[model samples]
Target: MSQKQKILIAIAGPTAIGKTALAIEVARYFNTEIISADSRQFFKEMSIGTAKPNPQELAQAKHHFIDSHSIKDDFSVGNFEKQAIACLGKIFENHDVTVMVGGSGLYVNAVLYGFDELPKASDALRAQLNERLKTEGIELLQEELKNLDPDYYAEVDVYNPQRIIRALEVCLSTGKTFSSFRNKQHKERDFDIILIGLNTDRELLYSRINQRVDLMIKDGLVEEVRALQAYQHLNALKTVGYSEIFRHLNKEWTLSEAIEKLKQNTRNFAKRQITWFKKNEGIIWFEPTETQQIIDFIKEKLITTTK
Candidate 1:
């Protein structure tokens, strides 16, 4: 008889979509563990802003990759893919299934389909791009990228200078659009993947995003950003909540304005996430409240796969 295939249930969706709760529930149902693919939550320094699992929720299930690295460390999607696969290997030793959850589509895809090997940017090129960012401003880089690779520009977080710079570096170095290198071929994985994407109405998701940002502020998000002020140059700190608050600290905007920008940026981020996940036809969509239905669907898939 063939051995039972170990399955990796990937819980994916936008910010404030309750992926963490659903992942924990699914892990508990399968008597398995969870691997978090949320790139923002991986750093130990980020907590309230990242919406990491609370003490009670974390204690309810075994979760790996949360607070697994220091923000000072140079972690990339490639690194995550390597580390997460190793994590899943250990997890699969004792269980037939493991749950992976996050809204970071690239990180999730890294585990599902390994990244294609691309040419590394030289230090000179990186320094040149950084210099250009310092002098020309982000707008120039954004416009250039849009002209060069409209496909990537459409989905990329335009607010993220690091991501924009990286894509530009690749485009400049290879004389090709950065999107051309993505998913050109797939890397095989040992386990089967089932993607469960949680979604709700657009207005409802926006409301949740706004409310979540408010909660983050009340929960001392400003203080958190203040603490990490020294590391603002780090790529990890360039994220949504921290970046907007950094602008406030820099006196570019009032605290109230910064908070508003935070909400707006978060909503924009969620929209991009939905766009990215929608491209993946394999994802089985459901509302966040339908936990039982998701579990049943998973079991049904497992039964069919086994048969």
Candidate 2:
């Protein structure tokens, strides 16, 4: 393979669409290591709930960022972008191509197109705003956002209190309009990124999500979450499978009802994932089964980019 330029082969898709299997295959094809972009899979304690790769899959390829952190640690996407870039710099020294795969679009984007440094707000400020939202109604918040950051107000969903508050959070905290933080210039990187998305029919995608949820339950997902009940309040534990199981353990629902909710929530999450990835027009889409075709496509892209 030509080392004229480096390429990161990113395999992205909704949950259970075979991104891990395809990434392993591509890594083998290029004799390259894999970098996980899955945010949930970073924690060592999160296994079945995150659908992390099995021992066999890990053995197939040298992977990075899997089981790399503790759930107790506060690992933000900004931290990930820094560490992942440093990791890629080391990988690029030996190989021209590296495979990065995951369904977490935000984390993937953090590495692909680094985010601008937006200032964080105080918890007290957030609590104050949320309390205002409770007493004053969304209209007050909407009006506040419209007056505070008209540009973001025009673009954001005015009805969404969360969106309005997020904008207002930046505005009120920084004394700058949230729109100023919106369009960040893409970070300059030495390596190139070629994004490949796994495409599936909507019904098939939902079915796959449901099946994966079932398999997680069968693989002792509840036991795993139960063991981590002490840490259930952590943001990392607030994901689909674990969250539903936590509620069930709290006697909010029966086991079967929890499973049903888990399945439905996962399907909805997959829908949202698809919607998030679709916004990036650069992604080349394919069925997960099209391994050979995907490989060929990557080879062609690598050649074209090198020239």
Candidate 3:
């Protein structure tokens, strides 16, 4: 599909690196819409924790898949790949290029390269992994995955238990590394892909992540999490910010401690996201301030690809 006239301009990077703003700018430039690949932002129940776009951002350019589902719904990466392809088809009907932005490596890759049908684990196996999560903490499973499938570990959001548990389930059930089942062959789609990545120095990136977490708390992240206490056991609430606050609510930690943990965990998540996107050599990196340069690069790619 490299020669295809249609294009999917994928903007990828660590959290709080300005992918959303860049994608909106690109989409507005092309008079095209954005197809979000952010796995968390899809749920309506998630807001401050996910750093979803503000109303102004959504108004700037039409977006798809943001707040498009409920936390109760089971949306798999494969489901996202299938739905995103269908959404892209509609976007390509009017424009030659559309933008997809996110920090999620798995969902992004699932869209670009077809997802592999990994062998499923039995209910008992999944329960056992969840039990481990309850007793041993996510760190143990993270270490196990690191040893078993270091490739996946380097890229995966290690804090996401659903992902970690699923990978381990496959590893334990099949006696094979979970990464072994990934798609080595690229999937052909109707559109060409132009991958873009955003980043900054580690210090600045971590600072931004810390500040973002601080802002989330200021913006009522605790209130939001508290409202969803009954559903805290749900996988969507098992994420960094919410989980930290849940610990606070459960009297396991002070609010200040929870806030500090939230910042630290977010910084760690951003680091992993950088690792994941950096592995894709096709992505052209830029600072968040280099918006014009990115737009110019996109125009250049479009000309060359069309020719």
Q: What local lDDT score does residue 3 receive in model 3, on the 0 to 100 scale?
A: 30
- Stretches of candidate 3 off by over 4 Å are 1-3
Candidate 3 on 239-273: residue-level lDDT in tens?
Answer: 88889999999999999999999888888888889
What is candidate 1's lDDT per residue for 2-79, written digit by digit as tens?
Answer: 223888899999999999999989998899999999998999999999999988999999989999999999998899
User: Considering TM-score, where higher is better, how would the candidates rank from best to worst?
Assistant: 1, 3, 2
What clash pairs does model 2 have? none
When summed lDDT is taken over every stretch of 10 residues in candidate 1, the lowest stretch is: 1-10
- What candidate 2 gets wrong by more than 4 Å, as runs, is 1-4, 127-168, 171-180
Ten residues in sequence with the least summed lDDT for candidate 3: 1-10
Q: How much lDDT does candidate 1 score?
A: 0.91
Q: Give the Cα lDDT of each candidate.
A: 0.91, 0.85, 0.90
Better candidate number, 1 or 3, judged by lDDT: 1
Write candidate 2's Cα lDDT for 1-307 as tens digits.
4443789988998888999999999999999999999988999999998899999999999999999999999887789999998999899889999999998776788888886777788999889988897799667998988898775554443433555676788999999998688437888777788999998999988888888888999999999999999997676786778878988999999999999988987887777678778878999999988999999999999889988
**Number of the top lDDT candidate:** 1
RMSD of each: 1.3, 4.6, 1.6
